[model samples]
Target: MDVPEALYLPDGDGFTATALTIGPWDAAHQHAGPPAALLLRAAEQASGIDGGQTVRLAYDILGPVPVGPVQVRTSVLRPGRRVELVEAALSAGNDRPLMRLSAWRMRSRGDAAPATPLTHPAPAGPEESRPERAAFFTTEVAYHRALEWRFAAGTFNGPGPAIAWTRPECALVAGETMTPLQHLLVMTDAASGISATLDWTRATFANVDLSVALHRPPRGEWLGMDAATVHGGTGAAQCNALLFDADGPIGRSSQSLFVEPR
Candidate 1:
């Protein structure tokens, strides 16, 4: 079989997941990134939201999304001239939703004042970094392989915080160009795994939900994350990341984790 060039292949009203969607933890399931991006793509294409941009996105992972055909349904939850709420759901066949996303889209005032001066300086750009692979990637063809990773601060398997730059090697869907938010969303879901503090072999830390808030549309192909995970001993954990582009800081992302010993 030939390897797919994109993460997903369009199928009717749904999409077919390719090997590129597989995560490090499972070959049969998909990493949250691609599916999240798909949901956002659906929302962005939905009617009545043409003039606005998504400012916030929250995802609830109901279950492991199987690596196969999945349907995406999007609707406008609350309509407004200045702001709107959009919802999207992904499901396999008639099964319950595997993931659900709610997004807030707001109109941009092009006449607004300049953005506040960036307090924290930008991290080292991708040109100043070296390429590295994630230590936890066990599968030959997985989501990890779909991105180009260049670390500016920490290694993939190293404990504590990490600062890294990532760019997608392929499109989210074949024949489609990914928007800036889609690019950022596809990389933000890995914040917890890349910045894990627990031993990968001894324990499992999987994020149950992901939320992102952006102050401005990210620019450029490379997106940066300064990420860290905090485990609270009681089987619950939180991961946070300051999102960036080559120009400067753009937003923040966070995930709620379900931690357990293997």
Candidate 2:
């Protein structure tokens, strides 16, 4: 069998997180991004589409998903002709839940209506951009190595707002065509990293959940995020992003963050 360059290796029963999927802390744990995208893969399968596009995805990171063998199960919670809601759960063993997700797939109403209020302009293309190789390029995790990043505005692993163009350099699951939805979902988690508000040394912020809403299926392979992070005095932070395709604005994403002193 051919090797996968992306996040997971597909097995007979389920999939396993590779070295690329390692989290910020340890090699044994996976970053929320790749695992969340994997949940979308399962959700898309269970959605039964009937005809709609996946418009929204919400993921709750139940606990640390140990890096290695993991099983994902997706089911339709609410089924409809015009709309469908599907959910996916990731478990490693003993039925212990690691992550849960809910996705909404909605079909076009065939109404002659204008789409988004405004389409955000995409930044410069990735060709004119630079790869992120900062001092914070600490480890060579599978997820970091698996993606090709091009920064247009801000710097990654820094304290500032950022606009970046991103593309998955590898496959999500072996042999499975990485769908546009899967591509977009994975990038949403990186929004926080692209636009960080706190010092990584003094404080650590890990997202507890990710939520994304798309107006339409993105066109082209490259995706972009005009991302920002806001910290509250109370111990919480929010990462919000305006999502765009190579063409124009498609949707938005948000992450709830848990902040702590490192």
Candidate topping lDDT: 1
Work out how many backbone clashes candidate 2 has. Answer: 3
Misplaced by over 4 Å in model 2 are 1-4, 109-112, 134-138
Pairs of colliding residues, candidate 2: 19-142, 20-142, 20-143
* lDDT (10s digit) by residue, model 1, range 40-102: 989988847566778999999999999999999888999888899999999998848999999
Compared with the true structure, all predictions reach lDDT values of 0.88, 0.81
Please give the lDDT score at residue 109 for candidate 1: 84
Q: 39-116, model 2: which lDDT tens digit per residue? A: 988887777665568888888888988989999998899998778899999999758788999999987666858775
Quote each prediction's TM-score: 0.96, 0.92
